[model samples]
Target chain A: MKTIKQISVFSENRPGKLEKVTKVLADNGINIRAITIASSEKFGVIKFLVDRTQAALDLLKQQGFTVAQNEIMAIEISDEPGGLHRLADLLARKKVNIENASGFVIEASKKAVILVEAADIEQAKSELQNEGLRFLSEEEIIQ
Target chain B: MFWDKKIETISRSGLERLQLKRLKSTLAGINKNVPFYKDKLKKLKIKPDKIRNLEEIRNLPFTTREDLRANYPYGLLAVSLDHVVRLHTSSGTTGKPKAILFSRKDIEQAADLIARCLVMTGMKKNEVFQNMMSYGMFTGGLVMHYGAEKVGLLVIPAGPGNTDRQISLMQDFKSNAIHITPSFALYLADVLEKKGVDPRKDLFLKRAYMGAEPYTEATRNKIEAIYGIDVYNSYGLSEMNGPGVAFECPEKNGMHIWEDNFLVELVDPKTNGPVPEGKEGELVLTTLCREAMPIIRYRTGDLTSIIPGKCRCGRTHRRVSRMTGRTDDMFIVRGVNIFPQQIERVLMAIQGVGRNYQITLDSLDDMTVKVEIRKELFDGKVDHLVNLQNTITEKLRDEIMVRPRVELLEPGALPPSEGKAKRVLDNRTL
Candidate 1:
């Protein structure tokens, strides 16, 4: 099973929190490949697919930021109307519940990748692979 | 092991006899020297000598904080200024602070009571004592210092804050005991963790005297676990010669109030009548030994109850439960009485909740509790964090009877712990 590390940082929902988080990453020269922020009224968790996962995690932690490295699968699909629908249908058939997801287009109208966080990552990965779906490796996602 | 073995283990009848004698003298002293009490007693036509039994104390007019404030700055002095060697004021957060004066004898008596408290807690001679409470007008520092010295312990008089210096002093001097607030103790635990210093291995601290603030038993357990030391609860107010009013014996069940020095009463806050036996109520105290300021039936505004049974230590003095909260500290939310300590009790018992929490009541009478989540507990899962929030909300609702909005914050988001933590922020207009 192939998986990529997604760095998630806990932040209080207040001004300058994002700036502080981004500043740490920018100073350490960690390039963010993809980003998603899920927030409630009082706080938020900022998840990032970064080029250098370990360095980013270490830098954020050293800067006193609460961070965690999560294993998630990123799968590419054709950038069309049925791109996400087909992936969702397949995961639904396999009973893989996506706990969290975020995506970005690699090429306009050509291809895109969806970051999938499921309850059981290894099971989800094997189930998806048995369905002939390929997951982007860490190097592939970073590139 | 006892400072005054005869006094500490006196029979109930003997203790009552001594208390009655001292009570009579205190009344006479105040009647002659303090015009305020003299006028009050004259209005009631109650003569000091006619008061034969302790139950007659109920006839005495209560001295309230307002009364103390009204008689501030020597208005209630039972002795002349020439005899008053010291003065300390209560931390008056509401209005004017109450002024408390002490003659040389009063100071010595206060120190003697403190010595009794310290020795009861198993503090010994030649032990290094680090005093971390503030000095100056705050009686917690100096009174405990004098008492520790009386016990022949080497007093450090460190006087709060300067955590780095405190740790170094503990390590270098091999201090065996300390006097500190519970909030500061939690902050010190954090500092020890950050410095990679194990208290059990790196320092020689044996016990901590935690007082000057009301803390939950859960907080005490947490501090005890972190420091690997016994945390004894001490109760006092500046109005009553702080930090020596009541102290826990080694059994740690409840604090024994020195009956020879104080007459204790537990009265309902609403009716000002005595609560049923062993029931919680406002603590009313009468000083039997204070020379410069002998307060009669002083309503302490602190809420506690008398433990029904005698302690295992066999002290004739009765024991009082830990202070649940002050009368003024209780807030009515949705017509239900709730204390900030209840919220703290719930929060401290949870696994991942941090030390600092604040309860904010808005004008709408709605409550919002802001809790700091431990940094290590943040596992990057929003669901886990949400579950924690729900757990806190449910536990708090179960404890307080009113559901509160619980906000999970990152560690260090709230104000840093310092001297006497303010846990409640009431914004209600009423």
Candidate 2:
């Protein structure tokens, strides 16, 4: 089953918006699976999924910041400069435009987060898998 | 305008005689007054006797835009600055305006040619001529003011932008003629209609002479429909003479070139050779009678054809077609050749956006120039702002071949100019 993961991103309301979110994931045992933020004029909704979403949400909620969990993707990508190119090329052949993406690669555990939106999410997943691309599930990044 | 030019467009036979005489005089003037020309003539071993007619006048070196720009301010003035009474210049976008100095006699002669053009466009002796072009330092207003007065017509130097008051003057004075740009005229007519004032019914306006910028046929129709007046196209430049180069007769087919006042040539801008008749080329002018700062073969950069067929007006003065467009103004925007006319056409077609947009080039972090369009607003509504911006951005991207960030602004927000309508706002070059 193709499952979308949700990771909790605890970001400071001030100077370090994205930096705070990245620092929280690096300190914890949880890996930032995938994330996206929907922002309004002022406050923003940081939506993401971690390997240990339940634990990350609990820890971030304890920090007293408005923490929320939302569905995203943590597709397992090869730790190469253009590994995403191979993944993106497959999606592009299926006519999918990546609006955002995020996650950590297992090869070097190079924890990176991205937010993406595509025209057809179902087609993008299927085409990537059929092209022998591996995807990190919600359970993979946390440990 | 040529009293100082001493150019009174004479008949062909008379022109031959005048050409021979001016040829001798010009050669003598060059030899005596101008050391550069004298040195050039000496280097060529050509004397005054060697130059006989207009053909030999061609043997002289052609002056270019570079020459004009280099010798700007008072450098090109043949006469002393104290003798020069009047001054005017164009708003050169690239650099400083080409300051033109006219002597007292130069002003009167220019006024005379403009007056003749006013009559050609059917201005009566006693009718009021409202000069709506910009006044002070710009030739459009001053030339029309002096020209109408010389022809025994009452003059109203109202200039432009005061639409409500100008309309009142037209109605109260029973003004018969108005001289302004076609774009402003259309804007005025639209204003009149919205204010529940019909120009033809609510006021008295007989004709309008429009120039200073090129416009389309559709614009002409709109202006005519709103004002219920004949709008004649007039062509001129500060370099050659202001406001009386050529004018369309009632037929509106083409403007009759005043052969007596000036000599016109259709030169291929690229090849610099004479273009065949009926073919469009850059209109090169030679003022037959300019004494102070006399310009020779000055290129207008306006694309047009010298149509040689006889007109029904029966003057036998050769006619030039109203300027079609320009070859110089074409610019490459993201590898797409964009003309202001194209953007204006699309803008006029769209009803929502006002006629006050400014295109700006902004630098992005990617080391590329991006176009940022500040959309002029018709009404102050946020909903409409988003919609119009989106629509215009899409349309402009499709037509102009580059994507632009469109931001809708409240009406009356763009910068205003007291002299010329500040339509083009380019900050990238700076």
Please report, as a residue range, the 10-residue window in candidate 1 chain B with the lowest summed lDDT: B410-419
Evaluate residue B6 in candidate 1 and report its C-alpha lDDT on the 0 to 100 scale: 95
Cα displacement (angstroms), candidate 1, residue B298, comes to: 0.5
Regions more than 4 Å wrong, model 1: none
Clashes of each: 0, 24
* Highest-scoring model, TM-score: 1
How many backbone overlaps does candidate 2 show? 24
Model 2 lDDT at residue B75:
62
Writing each residue's lDDT as its tens digit, candidate 1 over B261-329 gives 999998888888888758999999999989888898989989998998777898879999999998788
Q: Report the Cα lDDT for candidate 2.
A: 0.65
Question: Per-candidate TM vs. native?
Answer: 0.97, 0.64
lDDT of 1 at A58: 87
Tell me the alpha-carbon RMSD of every candidate. 1.4, 13.8
